[model samples]
Target: MIKEFREALKRFLVEICEFVQERDISFPQRPSGKYQVEVRDGIPSIQPIGIKPKPDLRALDTLMVGLRAWEKETFGNIMEIITRSERLSQAFLTSATGDLISGNRTMVFPKIRPIIEAYFAETNSFDFQQETFNRICDKVEEELRRLPYCSKILQCPVVGIHVSPNCSDCCLQLESDLQVRSLSLEEIEEFLEYPPFLPSFFTTVVEMKKDMEIFKQQLCFPEKDKKRIECVVIALRLLFGDRIFVPFQIERGQGILGKVLLGEQQSYSLEQRVVPPPRLLHIVDQEKYTELKELYHCISETLLERDRAKIAFSDNRSKQRVELALRKWSEGLDQVSAEWKLIAHWIALEGLFSPSSRQELSFRLALRGAIFMEEKEVYQKLKMSYEMRSRIVHGDYSPDDPQLTEIALTTEEILRRILRKILQQPRNYMPDQLEEKLLETLTK
Candidate 1:
């Protein structure tokens, strides 16, 4: 397989070199326009006045055809092996190829043109191309061998957290594999270079560039390993009692020409208007960092057990109910509105506590939850929150109502506690066992 791949790579490089030679001969000689860099409010943008003759793309088309044939004949088998080992879908390679050919900001061929041009500067020797091809093959083989063991690192922009400056790297190592670290100078400079367009004339590009500094810290984790990390984020929100979240993430270590690949920004409802600003950045010292790590483990362990249960009993009703409840909880975290969040949380609670029927839902929910938690006040709190839930759903409550905020917070805490308890010993909280425990409590 390696020998075949090396041969194909050599052929591809030879074709690329020939195409470059041919394209340069056919290139237009006359200058069509002068390009200038214009700085507006401290943002530099290229301004081109006249139309330049288009480069002959026929050579590029021929090279692409050869590349496609190589992919089908040789790379396809290697990709299959990788897919099986990585548990990636069939579309993974296709998506990667699409990104290489038609990425928004950069394309692979154009970016590599400079390096190729430098290689052929002195002489277009076949021996030099062969040396280049051999060097590339060596690197490609090494990469293929390491690919399965390697994982993509995703740097998610985290709001409402900062690392203490006294720390060595300004990073908090949450786990061996996960960390909260300040963005590197390269990443910050990249942000400044490509500032988002102003939403209005009122917001200047310079002001937007200043706002980019708000992203001081990021949550770093393996892209494919986000399940536990996601639980950790939720745990952080629960611990801080604030809207600490990841708005967007960028995949690192896959840059072309010093430009990193940008991930999609999360869409928000109209009510959100804009991504919520950082409230108060909490500096994470050692003690607080330890606390954060421990809470993350607690939450992640529960989720891990739930996943195990699902795998063990794929069609188990109890497992299915727990899955639904967990989904609702995650959806609640995604919601920007307190009302929607409260509703989503209540639905999750229903999946956990009221799996069978909605008969006497309020009473059963409050009683079962309170007894399970071993707190009498929980019963009253849940009962009141259930009433508020009814009012919100019925469209009788005002969004500005002070009780809305209070109930949202209270219900979130209650639900978080309940989930943690149930997840700690999922078998004990299965529907039948839970009902038995509630009956025993009532009898007592």
Candidate 2:
């Protein structure tokens, strides 16, 4: 029965933590009760009172009296009750027992004895002791389990080494979101200190509270409104030790599509004349137009080499040789600032941006404008191909907005088409190719 009592006492301590955790309360910082501690034959019993004054010693005294009566009605005098219900104060004393037999002295093993033997001597009866002892032990164990565990460290065995769940839930959520496959122990430790997951667990709780405020406004009627909100509140309470008040603010959704469309409007109205001018043809005079015309012809004639080679005209004009010289002379005109302006003005005046309508929402409109204004439909198709390339340069239009996705995809297609055209012999083999061919001819 004594053995059973000892085991019960140990379990009693363990149960304190369990009880405290269930109630979401903590154990007192210091020991309490007149029986601040207690002891059995060779073991100690400790009772924790969380941040409270000593418990009623009257209850402990009643228990000790009952224990004493049980001992007296059973094994009697050897049992002494210190009267303190606090388990940790139960101090056990062990002493060596000596025996003398047949004129010889021998030392026996240490025998545990009550340090207060005088108090135990007053007890008298000897009966069925073990049962009585068990009764007293059961009472003590019950009382001990009602107390809180003195330290969080003691609760470690019950819950794993993880920090409070409230604190860890955010990272746990983020990891799941980012599809982080696995994190080594070292990675977890580092993440505990870094952004997106860093800061004390309490900080996360406060942040979650703030998020809740935002959600309250954004999700006016969430599916599990109360439960979801309460979960966040409770998590915050556990994560951060704070009295929190969260505020809600609406987020604005202004985007590139809207901006670009407005820009197109402004462009046609010439409202943003102060902003940088669009990168398009800007030619003004007839001379510049003529120069641009000749340059385009020179460039196109050189590209029509296969057709030129097939034709056998023994004319003294030597059109091929003359055209070659014209192409070289036109190349200089292509670089002239005046010709570039003509092309720019022609593009701007092409009615791509309807004066009465909003500006284009995307670079596609810009590309389409350049295409329409160019002299040839072939040039229009060639310029149209580059829309996607320009769109990519613009980057993502807006956060959490899918409108740009279709535009981006279309832009990509235009770029691919333009790239294919650029790779064609005419667009691909440029003046650079001509210069190399001419150099070869001169060397020959």
Candidate 3:
């Protein structure tokens, strides 16, 4: 494999040099008197006497085509090994070499011009070229063999929560790679800035004069360790109520600021705009933080257990039901409208109860949920919210209706409580078993 790789590298170097030399020869040189003033019908206009020709990249295109063919045939295994190395991956990302090899020709010529020049500077000797190619191959092999001890830091801003000054150093280690901790003021300021641009004269600097104003607390994890962290965020929402959320933007959707400034009904395409950063509204003490960590652990463990069961029993209905409920729960929290949020939560409840038929689904959901939570009053709340859900779905309810807020809140609370109880004891609360348990409760 090493011998083959070295031979391939030498051939690539030779072709790259030839391509660069051809490009240099064909590249256009500046012409004197390139522009001239011409008069047409008593009107004077500036016109170009000689137009600058665009660079012909046919040689580069051919080189890349051949390189891609070589990569497809003989470079797959070596690339896999290189990309898998954390140190190598970081190096590639920083150096833009990854972009270069992936057929991004924009920066390829500039990047390799110096190296090609150095190779040419030598006395037209094959030995020097071979030595340089050997060094390149050896460096790549050394990097691949070296043990990766470097770790990647991924920090996500936590909205609506602050770490208490008393526990500034308290890092909630939720998993081997995931944790919640407070960052320094400097670090928090990094996220608060607007995306870079040339500012207009109208742009004014507004200072945040208050102490500890910005959200400094963040969910930190190692690279690729963010799996199921969204579920953990859902768990936190359940624990802390709806006072918090991590804000996210849809790439293909209209910017929120654009919609607000322009009327909501007005359609426009504005991909970039400054928006308010999500704020920290609540302070979390050590005790509450501990509870949050425990809840996160419980939810994460339940998900892992369900995943394992899903693999073992391919047709595991219980696993499917639980996952569906969790997804709906997460979706509900993501909604911007109160009506949609209520409907999403209700759908999650339906997923949990799995009513035998659509007939009397409200009653069944209420009964099953109330029974699961050992709270009789929960049934009345569930029934009323389900009725409101029906009204909203049928277009009978107005968006301006004052009761929508209260009902949405009530429905979300009920769903959160039911989900919490189910996640707390996953084994005993399987959908089928929970129905049987509710029947047993009714008999008693």
Candidate 4:
């Protein structure tokens, strides 16, 4: 690659020399003689008596000055070419060499060094600038092999390119390079001022964090109540399947910012951990599970607690619906009196617990088919949920304890998971009844 650049440089300089010599050859000086002056109308002109000076050669001094200027210009052009070629060659060379070389030694074209040496020997007065250019190109190419575009540029066909290389850097060659084009300095400033131009990975992390915030806010109180937090995690196991602390750890505090998961603590970026699944909350593959787990932890930690008692709950219709639904299962339990938050949490638990009896199984299947799916992640969540159900059903748990001062706090944990799943997915959890209502509204 260096050889090609050096060859190009040599060709350009030689061409410039040819142009200079052709325009600056000495001509026979015109015989020193006086010229006859003639008057025509109001103008007077002088005519040469002997052979006139050759137009091409008469301006030798000016041509010599221009030739020198062009020599410098040609050298500058070489520097520019060499600099650009070196930049691209680095990209190409890195890609071509892979990780085989220790460093950038991948770009050193040892094959072309001899050719350069021969060129200098033949042209006794070689351009010192060219030699320096060659050394830098060779050294950089050999040294910085790991640079993103180094391997890419080295492989690009410079000669065949139709346009000027100065125009723009192609993304293919940039290798994750991001450039913001703006017409004016103000526009550039605006782009730079925009805080969102973090790395693509960072942008994704921010989004995941936002979702987790909303989930936490939703989980803070009963489902009927809404919290101010922005994001919520829908499914915990959907996020952290099997292991608890492998991908991320939960961070909790007083404020919204405090609840945020410190994704930087992980070895991989959030992007690596939480790649959005093809379907929300559908934990079919590993990526889906990873995304869900990260979300769950974040939501759980950030979830706020409601300050006031259950008075500011959702409307009576929702309350009545809850009462009717749970009346058959738990006779004494007032699903209606239960705070909307608690009711939503309980509904989520019922959905996740996978009721054992045939009648209960039918309800579980109905809920699963309705809002959730029967995936591995969901099954694992069901297992976790049943542990809570065991404490609530088997043990002497209280329903009227307002503060949930009962046998255990499994309800809260199960509620958190269910809420996270809800936050992770709202549309899926949208009741079939609600879908019908929406369709009815649309038709109306």
* Each prediction's whole-model lDDT (CA): 0.52, 0.28, 0.50, 0.31
lDDT of 4 by residue, 1-444 (tens): 455544543553343334323444221223452233333442322344564332222323431232334343333332323233343223223322242333434434332322222222222234536654455344433432332221100010110011112334211111122111112344234223323322211101111121122112222122222211112212222233211111221212222111121111111212123222222212123344345334533333233332323122133333333223222222112123333324444554454333346465534533443334423354444444444444455654456654443312333443344444444453344433433544565699
User: Who is ahead in lDDT, 1 or 2?
Assistant: 1
Worst 10 residues of 2 by lDDT: 151-160
Least lDDT summed over 10 consecutive residues: which range in candidate 3?
Answer: 206-215
lDDT of 1 by residue, 43-155 (tens): 32333347633433343343223333433222332222222322111112223334322344333323333223322221223343454435534444543343222123445
Candidate 4: lDDT over CA atoms? 0.31
The candidate with the higher TM-score, 3 or 4, is 3
Candidate 2, 21-51: lDDT as tens digits: 3444321232432212233443333333333
User: TM-scores across all candidates?
Assistant: 0.56, 0.18, 0.55, 0.20
Point to the candidate with the largest TM-score.
Answer: 1
* TM-score for predicted model 4 compared with the true structure: 0.20
Model 3, range 266-358, lDDT digits (tens) per residue? 111222433233233556678877777767666664555533221222235655676677767766766767899898888888878866677
Model 4, position 286: C-alpha lDDT score: 38
